[model samples]
Target: MTKKVLITGFTGQVGSQLADFLLDQTDYEVVGMMRWQEPMDNLYDLTGRINNKERVSVFYADLNDFSAIARMLEEVRPDFIYHLAAQSYPKTSFNIPIETLQTNIIGTANLLEGIRQLKEKNGFDPVVHVCSSSEVYGRAKPGEVLNEDTKFHGASPYSISKIGTDYLGQFYGEAYGIKTFVTRMGTHSGPKRSDVFFESTVAKQIALIEAGFQEPIIKVGNLSSVRTFQDARDAVRAYYLLSQESYKGNVPCGETFNIAGEDAYKLPEVIDLLLSFSSRHDIKVETDSERLRPIDADYQMFDNTKIKSFIDWEPEIPTSKMFKDLLDHWRDEIKKGKVPLNR
Candidate 1:
């Protein structure tokens, strides 16, 4: 019998990509939980991404509703559960702190609590993978790389929420005996990423410049802060492998791992790489004070040793290729006249 994996945030970048990759490469079946009011338009390029569409199922339930989500988990009894849903914008969190806390913190607690209750009744516990962000390691000393051992110092509401969620995963594992794996994801991006992410923001601007749709100037935020970028596809692979392993594998319950590439670059350098990839050198970057984070993290990177040793996963895609892929996505959309010049 094929194993069943219950995944939330089915429409998100990592969740969507993971669903496709697993359906194509593994015998496990994926049942996605989405909060859509009406059935979302069948995922675009569905057949191209997933080999076994027949094995996929979707449930409609709000993440805020514990009872509904609990009932779904009891009915499904998935062998693996991947919680990838959250409100994940750092800058936007300043304006919507309540919503961010409610979704990232409370929503996660609900899942953990629900799973704990279900495990007690069913006598079977599903291994869970909780996707977390590197932002939890806020304000690292200059030139220091973060790892599973890195102490957390949250600087913003968004980071605080993630920190709470990360600890919540541990609480579930230690206090309730639910096997849980936590991943501190770096800056993962791809073609379908939303514009809120810095990579996509830069790529879209380059696309506009290349198409002669806008001025040769791109507005940006703090350029001095450094971050390690990883491909979403690769990140998802690490997550999948982690979830499949035994509870006592290298990364056991309550353990955390960082998923990031080897190279660390500043925001300006990332923007430059994107421009160079597009072969558009004339563009100039302008620093906009409005774009700066209210509580900016000065330095950030992650050591992948723990996760790499445990799952034999590493960041294989080069930074240039990641940027190029995103550039191509925006360029394709421009060719189709989908996005406007003023956008």
Candidate 2:
């Protein structure tokens, strides 16, 4: 018997990588739910690599519409649901706070309601793994390590929305007897990350400079802020492990796990690392006021003991290797003419 797994935000970095991981499995059928308006280029690239279209399916639906979500849930009846859809960028949320709230909060409620309806109608409950963020912790005290029980003090509109959705998942699980596990992830990055993100932007700029397509100037924001970042590949693997633990009844419903990286790195340190991979050593780093956040945390870290003990998961990708892979990915994109060098 094949178990059907549904992944929302299928076109995003983590979701797409998760799909890649699942495509290698034999007994799980993967269904990706994405908005109709989203471009299909990433999906195309993903499916092209998998080669077996029969094992994976893409469903076009909006999370805001409960009816559509319910219908899709009824049709797929997925054994597991990884909810990753959201307005994910923190800085952009400052400009579109309302839209972020609608997409992240209401969107989460609709998905959970759809699962509840399915459970009521057919007594079918899927193990839902909700992707939350460490940003919900807001400004951690200097040198303090945040854990699952840490109080949320969301610093940005995006984090606030994530906080709402995070608790919503818990509420649905505890109140309605639905199976929900929230994974509060740290800053995970790798290949295919949007250029708007700090690390990707740096890597992209370096790649462009290396290709002689752009000038040797890198624009940056708060270089002193520190964050723990995991590789997207490693983070998705942990998500899969948590889902499996839920399915095996090893992880309790409504439990939240903090997926933290091995160490925290300052923004300047990361930028320096990317510079080391570049061909041009004379490249200038310019601080852009527009790129800086209105409110930024000085330090953020996560304590991953719970996840480690429960799933035996730890990040295997080193920081140097992660940045190298990101730079390599950008270089490939540049060579393929997919990335526009002019900013």
What TM-score would every model get versus the actual structure? 0.93, 0.96
* Residue-level lDDT for 145 in candidate 2: 84
Worst 10 residues of 1 by lDDT: 38-47
Looking at model 1, residue 302 earns an lDDT score of 75
Taken over the whole model, the C-alpha lDDT of each candidate is 0.82, 0.87
Which pairs clash inside model 1?
A: none
Best by lDDT: 2
Model 1 misplaced regions, further than 4 Å: 37-42, 47-53, 247-250, 340-343
- In angstroms, how far off is 86's CA in candidate 1? 0.4
Per-residue CA lDDT of candidate 1, range 1-343, in tens? 8799888888777778888888888988888888867334225656433445577877778779998888888888898999998988888898899999999999998888888888788676888988788889888999787878889999788999999999998777877768997888888898677777777888988898888887889878878888888888888888888887744455567677788877788887888778778676678888878778888887887788888677777888887898899889888888888674332
Q: Model 2: per-residue lDDT, tens digit, 40-95?
A: 65566666644667788888899999989998998999999999999999999999
